[model samples]
Target: MEKQILLQVEGLSISFAQYTKGLRRRNLQVIRDLGLTVRSGEITAVVGSSGSGKSLLAHGILGLLPYNASMSGEILYKGQELTGRLLENVRGREIVLVPQSVSYLDPLMKVGNQVRKGRKTAGALERCRELLARYGLPPDTESRYPFELSGGMIRRVLISTALMEEPELVIADEPTPGLDLTAAKRVMGHFREIADEGTGVLLITHDLELALEVADRIAVFYAGTTLEEMEASAFQREETLLHPYSQALYRAMPQHGFQPLAGTQPYAGDSYEGCVFAPRCPYRGEECSIQEIPYREVRGRKVRCIRPELAEMSGSPGKMDRSPDAENLALTERGRMA
Candidate 1:
């Protein structure tokens, strides 16, 4: 049995012109040469800080970007190139998005209408009730308008609508960022349930804990490029993260709080021949400043770094996978001795 490939994004690049009375600049490249794949059963969490273009990437896929923006890339859904009307046709059916805000719901419409409108078919409408019920919302909440629903109730509806199509892939962007811990857990639980049903999920969140809790794979994005991608378990392990940028991020977390790698993010217009994170990386040196960001090859991890130290990364405990080095060595030595 094979899990289906739901969506494939290749060479996806997006740019927007920026002019805020700054020293004359033509444009800013937001996301560049970014590639990602979502199989029908995996949840790939795109984690990064604010203004890091996580949401922009999701917007690029949805065709929701501003008209002034330019995007060039391939977005394939179920082996078909996603484009114009066909995109509109399959968007709700094969792909769905749960935005960060529940207010995205139409205030003028009843909750039922909104949910039913989530999908075009009568089957979807009927399933709307089922979805609401599944999330523990009263069936009657469907009859009420958006304003009438509580925050938690509205959140449930927003999630249910995205599930209406029984979509093969769901792109969730910080779906629980503002909610309380309880609400966030419940929301993450919904995604987990969706995944269990054989649907693929690309869960995008800055909350590393949230990503770890729900994601099977993690792709850490810096500036605009992928630094390192590994299994959720590897995120905490110091086994070796082959990129200096990712190492800086790994250290920046308060959980680690190791050293000061202080510097601002590179301006989008800056000439980044080297790694985008080079400036803030304390380990960076002469080679870094001159070299183009090289993509290093590894078994499973993609390291967009030139001075990648594979041995150091293979088992560095991430903020989550904090095991003492001696214990890990003992286990490895035992395996080798066996």
Candidate 2:
């Protein structure tokens, strides 16, 4: 049976204004015609190298993009369109974020207080206490500040906060990106609990194996577009990929990263044109640079490349499609998002 729809993102585009100082600021398109959806009780993992706009997409859903970045798209939740302040209000109630940064804890305040703060209702507060204990964090630790906890502990606290409200959807961006292997499992366990309860999970990460292990479905992004998506099980049983970008990603990842820490990640971007991966794709014909984009379908997947046949042989894997190929690197490029 088809799962009930929870969130639908359509034709979402984000652009930034380039400062030429003396001249009129130019609009640099960041995300172009991007679209995806999350359904109830499903674990949909969004994978791409850093700067592939994975995080940006999450922020966009929450209506949290920077002041300078402009966005156009229809985001529907329970059939209601999302934009502006309405999106902001709807986020924490129906959708909550486990940010790339731990938003669950106040670095200055006690951990427990933060969780309770996230919980607006008395029942949610009680649930928060239960969840923290369920994850093995002493309800007492809520008394401690973020600086005192270990990286793993921080993850737990954040998960507790995100789930404290028991929102129907979660946007977890690299939930355990920097944790040790043991810590990663614990964190994932918490997420598993949420999924088991029928929450829609949008997991953002570059670890394909991790997705293979846990995700019900996987969506691969490139150069601000959702190149393809498929069942995570299929990635393991066969190579059956329709998008060149997705295939390269599978090849580039250190297959064992999910179970054990291993290997370095490919850089986010290298060189590209037209299809972006044209510079590295082995199957590239001269037309790759001529602006001919290839797209195809295999089983239940949709690919956004000119040559889905050679995605593995066509390009290097494990990187964003030429990093933030567009000018909109992120809300504030002040810190060098690239």
Candidate 3:
């Protein structure tokens, strides 16, 4: 049985036009060659640090990029191109976003009206009450304005709003930021239920542990592009992970050693050629810095690194043997830095 691809983002890039001193205009590329797929009946988690272009990816999918931003590549929903027209018709209906910020709620609108999308009909009102209650909110919550709600309450309200529509695809951007552990787990469980019901879920969050619990697969983001996309089960062992950055992230988890990876991610405006993770990678070589590394499939996982050993290895289960050449590259990098 083939899984249905609900949404596909291929070769996606977003750049913002900004003016510098002396009225000089420059294009700052914030996202480059970003790609991911969300399949029906499963959740695909996009895990990355803040400013790694996660929210921007969500916005790009919905054709909601800001005025100064220009995007290239294709965004497909249900095997059709998701353009402005299609998105305009289906944006809040077939495709929904549980945005990270609670500011998305209108201050002037009551919570119930907002959830029901300004409808006051008895059915809409009853449904609104049901959703609020499901999330542990009282029936009176619908009468209150956004300002009257606490931060955690607002987060739950956002989830309720997104769930109001029977969306085919749900893009949740940091949906559990202000939520407690219990609430966050419940939110994730609701998304899991949605996926089980044959909807596609794109869970964008910095919490890798939480993602591993709910998502079937994880696409790791670095700087502005994806470094690795692998099964959530692959994260159970460091050796099962493909990209170095992915391994670093796994090791940084609290259950792991909580080890920190050195070096900062490159700024969006900073121009760079070759692998974006090269500057911090232990096995970085001259080619890593000079050559354009292609995103390729290795060991059943997609990775952007072009290391020869990674290319040669099959998708069999075992520890990856670091090629002597890679070891030398690491040694050479250390020597050069010294």
Candidate 4:
């Protein structure tokens, strides 16, 4: 059976307009030429270090980008373009966001009311209690306010709110923050269950190890762009990975010796002509700094780097699948070899 694509983002770019020292306006491009897809029955995790625009990508998809921020590129939901009106209609029903900030919950309202969306009916009340209990929150949690809950409990509450909607697509931005290792794994397990039940989940996190435990595919974000997207299994072996940053991430894993990559990610507004990772990449050539690299396929994985020879050396040699246009950005050929 063919897996259904729930959400697709193609060539998405996000920038903010700012006033400089002389009050002159300038644009800070935070995300550039990013692409990824989420499919039903799978969790697609976007992993990157801080300042890589992972959170911004979530906000862009939810149509919640700040006023000063401008976005270009296409966002499609269930094969239809996501417009402002359409997003408004489906924002909380068909699609839901488990925001990174616990502050998104109402400080004044009782936790139960917020989760139930102010419904007094018996079904809503029973459902709310069930969700809270499922996350290990006590029955009395409903009567308490946001300030009354611990960081972990509040995080669980936020997850419950999104789950309450029975959403087809769940975008969780750093959902495991403030959680201990065991608790974090538990949270990820819940998302795995959601995916197993056929909901498309886009989990945004900085923890590569946790992502590997639950995500079907991992899209590596770097300097506000995606460098490589591959199956979570590819991460098990350093040599199987496609891009340098991804290989670096695998090396940084505790089991892999925690080898750190040198150099910091470029600032958001810093201009770059070619690959953003070129400055730190050991294999970078002169052309890497001047040529525009297309996001191409290598052994069925989506990678933005133009180093096909490196991919071939890694045993991924094959004809690349090209995107016809920016809009349909090569939806990863289903059932292809990972």
Candidate 5:
């Protein structure tokens, strides 16, 4: 069966207006021309450094940007544009956010009441129990307040609260920050289970390694925009990856060489032409900094680099599959050739 596109974001730009030293106002754009699609039954992980606007993307999608923040983008949910009344209606119902911080939990409200959102019905009570139990929260957890629970427990409670409603799309922003390895893996596994049940999960995380483990697709965010989006399997080898920054991430992984990339990402307010990554990219040419680089498709993936082919020519062995299906065909062909 063909997968349904649950959420689609196109040309998303978010900027905040602020006063400078002399009280002069300026607009600082954080996210620009960002685009990605989340399909039902799939986990699409957006991985990037902490300050790369990943959280802003989540807030933008949920229509939760502050009053001073100006946003321009087309956010479509179930093929309909999510704006005005539509966004307000589904902000917390259809599309739920598992925020990065557990501080979202109410300090005064009890765990059960908070999870059920004050519903006293038997079904609500039962579901609250099940969700809490599923996350290893004890039965007595319902009676406790947010301050009484551990940080990891509070994180689990936040997840349980989000699951209280059958949300069609789940935007999890750094949901595993305070969780231990086992707990984090378990949480990610639960997300996998949620997606398998036909809910679209947009996982916003800085943990590329963890994202690669469970996400079907991964979108690499950088300098407030997506640099590469491809199948998770494509990250098996650096050569299989397209963008240089993505390759850098692959090398930075512990299993790889743990080699850190030189230079820092450009700040949001700093103005410069060309690719935001040109200053650090090894394959960057003069043209890369002359103009704004357009995101384009290359080898069955979306990449923003001007020279994606250089990764393929970097002397790494083995050919990459165009898609998951193509990977199987390539393997079969290789077997036959042998």
Candidate 6:
């Protein structure tokens, strides 16, 4: 049976108003035309490098963007528009966020109070203890403050807190950064358990390999946009991935020669005429510079490249010349300075 769509985002764009030199105001377009779907009982991993707008997507969904930020797009929850009062109502109840930073936890509050959200009832305490214990945290951990816990313990605490509420959708932003390999895998296992029990999980992380371990679908995020989205199994082989950036990521893995992708991602406000990844793409062509690259389905996979076919014609794995040319180097430096 097909799982129900829990969350749907379409044409999502986010821009922040910033004052330039001499008080000149400009809009820094951080995320552009991003879209993804999360189905109930499935985990959708939005994988990317840092500053790829993964965390911003979570903040935008919960209406937690900064005051100067402006968002224009459709965010739907269970077939209904999620905005204004509706968004506020579901912000931390039906929809929960496992924030990236441990600073999100109150430093002054004890773990028990924080996890149960200030509810002092006996049932809430019992539930909190159970949740913490489920994540390998001991019962005595409840009396300690966030500052007292180690990084890995704090990460587990955040997950335990998010699970305190029976949320329909859980948006976890880089939830395993501070954890050891064993702890990270354990945390991912918990997410899989929830997904198995019908909770839609949108996992935001830069660790592509870790995401592949538990995610049902993988959405490859580039500079402020989605480059490709496909099944996690597509990552098993480079050819299965449709986009050059996705293939490059697969090749960069430790098991796949660790071939570094050259050139830097464009800054938030940098202008792009066509595909953003063209500077680092081995299969880049002249048409990539001028043609409008639309996010479309190519050979049953969703991709955002005009010349995805070129990847196949290029050659065997690890053979593509990814060395940066003079032009690409100049462009990368310009993007960094921007």
Compare the candidates by TM-score and give the number of the best one: 6
Ranking by lDDT: 6, 5, 4, 3, 1, 2
lDDT of each: 0.72, 0.69, 0.82, 0.83, 0.84, 0.85
Per-residue lDDT tens digits of candidate 2, residues 33-56? 666778889888887666667788
Considering only N, C-alpha and C atoms within 3 Å, which residue pairs clash in candidate 4? none
Candidate 2 — what's its lDDT?
Answer: 0.69
Candidate 4 segments exceeding 4 Å error: 311-338
Candidate order by decreasing TM-score: 6, 5, 4, 3, 1, 2
Candidate 2: stretches off by over 4 Å: 20-24, 84-89, 118-125, 255-273, 292-298, 309-338
lDDT of 1 by residue, 197-270 (tens): 88999887877667778888778776665677777777674445556555555555557654324445554556
**Number of clashing residue pairs, candidate 4:** 0
Tens-place lDDT per residue, model 5, 105-214, is: 87788888988999999999999999999988899999998889887788788888789999999999998876789888888888898899888999998888888899
Model 1: residues >4 Å from true position, as ranges? 1-4, 19-25, 118-125, 252-261, 310-338
For candidate 4, report its TM-score: 0.91
Better of 3 and 5 by TM-score: 5
Per-model TM against the reference? 0.83, 0.80, 0.89, 0.91, 0.91, 0.93
Best by lDDT: 6
- Tens digit of per-residue lDDT, candidate 6, span 1-338: 87899998888999999999999999999999888889999999998777667799999999999999999999999999999888988888999999887799988999888999999889888899889888888889999988999888888888888888889999999888768888889888888998998999999988888899999999988898999888899999887788888887777787987666667788899998888888777777888988778888788767899878888565366666556363355433223211
RMSDs, each prediction?
8.2, 6.7, 5.5, 8.3, 8.7, 3.2
Candidate 6 Cα errors over 4 Å, as ranges: 313-315, 323-338
Error of 6 at 82 (Å): 1.1
Clashes of 6: 0
Residue-level error in angstroms, candidate 2, position 57: 1.2
